[model samples]
Target: MLNFERLQILQKYYDYIQKKTGVRDYFLVGGALRDILLGIKEKLDDVDLTIAGEPIGLYAQMEKEAFSHFITEKFGTITLIPKEGVMQGIKYEITPFREESGYQDVRHPDDIRWTNSLLADAKRRDFRINAMYYRFLNIKKPVYEEKKVLDSTTLLKVLDREGFVFLENSGVLIVQNSSLIDQLLQNGQMDSDFLYYLLDIQHFAYCYGEEGEKTDSDGRFDLQIVIDPEYGIHSLINRKLETVGDPDIRFQEDALRLLRGLRFVNVINQKLLNNENKEQNADPLNKVRLFDFETETWKSIKKNHDLLKTIAKERIYQEIVKSFSEGNPFGLVALVDEAEMLPILFPALAKTKGYDQPIRYHPFDIYAHIILTLWHLQQINSNYLVRFAMLYHDVGKVGQYEQYGLNLTREEIRNILAGPLNHRFSSAELMKEDFRNLGFSNKEIEEIKRYINEHHTPGEILMGNSQNWTKRLRKLFSEVGYEKLQNLLDINIADRLGMYNPLQNSSDLTDSYYLKTLVDEIEQTEGQFKKSDLAITGADVMEHFDLKPGKLIGELLQVGFDWVLGDVKHRNVKKQILANIANYLKQKK
Candidate 1:
């Protein structure tokens, strides 16, 4: 529980309620106490406060205060999230203290009875870690520290001192009673939603606190504690952090537990070498494989873009927008395993080569390379959400539409392996349709679409460059849009990593690492056409030469763009560019 932020917001809201309607002793139950001990923070976007013995007008005060971007009401409990910034839409729900009876749904109690006891309200939470509570008289001013351990420092130290403290390390404070966990697991309670999400859907489980609550025995007060890995809370915090705080909540929450899995793995490998620990952690666990971004895009396509159908387009758009602006997309793509999603992503290709890569060039062979690329991607930046644009980019290669392959023997043979020239183009269209489905706004789709199309354009430019690396990069940036230049490199990296021969037209260029020399060499110097150093734009060339902004001007820009890429000094006046274009066009003219 990140009690400070959680309670602070609740306290502020309660104080506000007191000021407006004179509501006192409002009950703040669930997750608030858990977050405080778990080293988490609260979001002021929406404040949820469970009013004691009342199910009305929780928002009379909020309606009077900073409520521009918000809408308020009381169905049973009051929910208010600050309607400022991206988090403006996030909701903070305040419910009246209530005891639940009879399970009509998997996670919700069918009947509700308003209660005055703190334990009754807290018992409704899914896990023990999420079931703690604190109550205050009003929201205007709060005594936050009372009976509340409001920071992670105290609990973290103790948990760290106790190694193999898996439950504590989870950052969720578990209650001693087991009944809460058991009840939530049963159908008809709202907790079943979380149970299904973590257990059936995601296949992860809660590390329940082993002890029991001595004071409250029907297990009504008992709760299991575990970190909420779902992005909702993180997303809520992420939307608000930009306004006043840093964006990383996990770092402040409990960085120890944040990378605990990675840390454990590292220690295991180290100790296995030195035999430091008595019991060996390894038991020859089979390596798991997942889809790379490209493969997942194909699978998503087969699923008919069903993933983001439930979330708002704006939310998806914002995430995509942030991904492009703040994160590494290629690396994110590497996490997706195309193999697992074959039938869905590129059923067309899966039937032909069986979605297999040409093994002679790849070490892990085709299936393994996809997984390898995702692994390599994880080693880089794990923060950014890779775009579906890039994810669907190479999916066309997976499906082997018999008609696509070109063979001299017969039309049937040619049709056997090669696809139409528009294979990737069709894939792009599918991607565009799913852009919003994948959580992108329409405005974001345009940029992403261009990025996808042009990802391969740079490789084509390099091929046409007669082996000019610097020229290739310049052409890539200018023509493709310079924003995702590094993204292009990441895509190239994934492509090379997933193949035996990603470079040459033939199998001759099989070794993936061999390109490191060339790629590094490209990185060591400047790219071909940096925006600051550019000699001329299409408009400039057309206006200067008294030329129409037609095919002629287009040709001139391409020629001039290439020229400037080869020589940095061409970034000067338009005279040299016009002169060169004159001569080049005169010869063709």
Candidate 2:
């Protein structure tokens, strides 16, 4: 018996479609099939169906049933959503069997032709493992319980003479359909050789074809059923799965697949390592090997790495985000570097690879330091903004010595090298286009820039004496805001931990205690630190000094705000402020 519980949704939808349009050539394809075969029990929110006939006919039938659907005539696909039933709210994407022609842009098909052959459609998919399909047959009894309703028995219905067949685990079962079998055999649609060939089990040599079948008195044959064990003999077989066509041609057809291939390599390596940890003596033969591409594929990618530049920035950004979101982002990035795509995708990161830092402060070069910082962020489970900040934090250090020259005075060098003013600002300025091109929202890009610009301020404040530290801390907090201050501290801590030295272990660059105390003090203190917080406004200044709304009012407020920053008591001295404004105006005249 088939796994009826696992096949209920497919069966229900198949039956519904067949009842409506009398179409029986639909099959469950794509990731749903791959996930089912992998025994991954995660809840899948979408179902993809490939039908051998016109989907628009099914679309018209579904419309009569009042089912909502979206049609795309360009690709011959329709997304149907049932209004009521066990599969309510679920979206099923139904597409007619079609083949793609040219991909001169490396992203889209230049021409699409409808086909009636399932095999032809399967051959056009990206990978062998994702190319399988599952066909389900309708039966008389209730196949499985519907979890969404209380009365499951009400769903059962008797079938007519049309008959039904269910395909499961890459094998098809015809239920009470001997005539359909004979029809398939005569029409060259469902012969045993074709079935076994589709299942990749022909090597077992269990023939169910016309040559070796036992015929009943009515001339119907009973074929021997061949099932692969759970830990099947196929696991022992080694097969190299190339792309459907030439690997170079595939990459040229879609350059994004190059990055996808690298991601797969890292993902496969991680899975292998996890499996190795679970079973110390696991057979090496049981592991799925990485896809070994032809040498020409690598050559084509290296030659056409710039083709990635031609792809939509949003698409490239999505691939980059997926790479970083994986368990092994560092490894994946290393692979990107190996493929020479990093320079094209992230020229900022590429420039940092060999740039050296002062040995006393940094143990690794600029690129390694950034990677180490990212590793720290990963350890803390930091969000993407913090991780991205760490990635570009020190990229501005490249060519700094040559740009600024080596003969600068200590104070001048410090001013130029300060995070907020020079390197951080420069890096943020340089990355604006890169970040925007990578599909980051304007708000996200600004926030990242804020983090990079202020990453060093927290440490600077923490290392200061308490005398002026509050003022500095308040300024930093006001500039970066409360939410971003936390992120800035995270980047600071990661950057400090990433530095190389004997004392690195002892450093608390984030200075959580001190920063927290500063936060608490700022919260408790009611005095003005900003011009807007001054007790006297620009209107007060203009009225008291007998001046209209002009530059003089703003100048007077700045002087008062400066005094307030140095001593909060200055905010209450209205008469003294008026006297100071007069003197300041006298000096200006």
Candidate 1 lDDT, tens digit per residue, 1-589?
A: 2222223344454455455445454434443443333333344444455544555533444353433333333237555544454445555566766776554322234577776544455444432233434433211111112222313344344333321111221222322223433443232122434432322221122233222222233323222333221211222222211111121221222222212212222222332333323335644463211111123223333333222233344444454344333333332232212223333323332332335544555544333454444344434424233344445554444443322344446665454424443434554565566554555556666655665555555455446645576556655555554335655555555655446554433333332233334445544554434554556777887676677767877677777656766665444457787677777888886
How close is every model to the real structure, measured as TM-score?
0.52, 0.67
10 residues in a row with least lDDT, candidate 1 = 238-247
What tens digits encode model 2's per-residue C-alpha lDDT throughout 207-281? 111222223455343222222111111111121233445666667777787776666555545544544567768
Those runs of model 1 whose alpha carbons end farther than 4 Å from true positions after fitting are: 1-48, 53-55, 61-63, 66-92, 97-131, 134-354, 363-368, 382-390, 404-426, 455-467, 480-483, 500-550
Local error of candidate 1 at 45, Å?
6.5
Per candidate, the number of residue pairs that clash is 64, 4
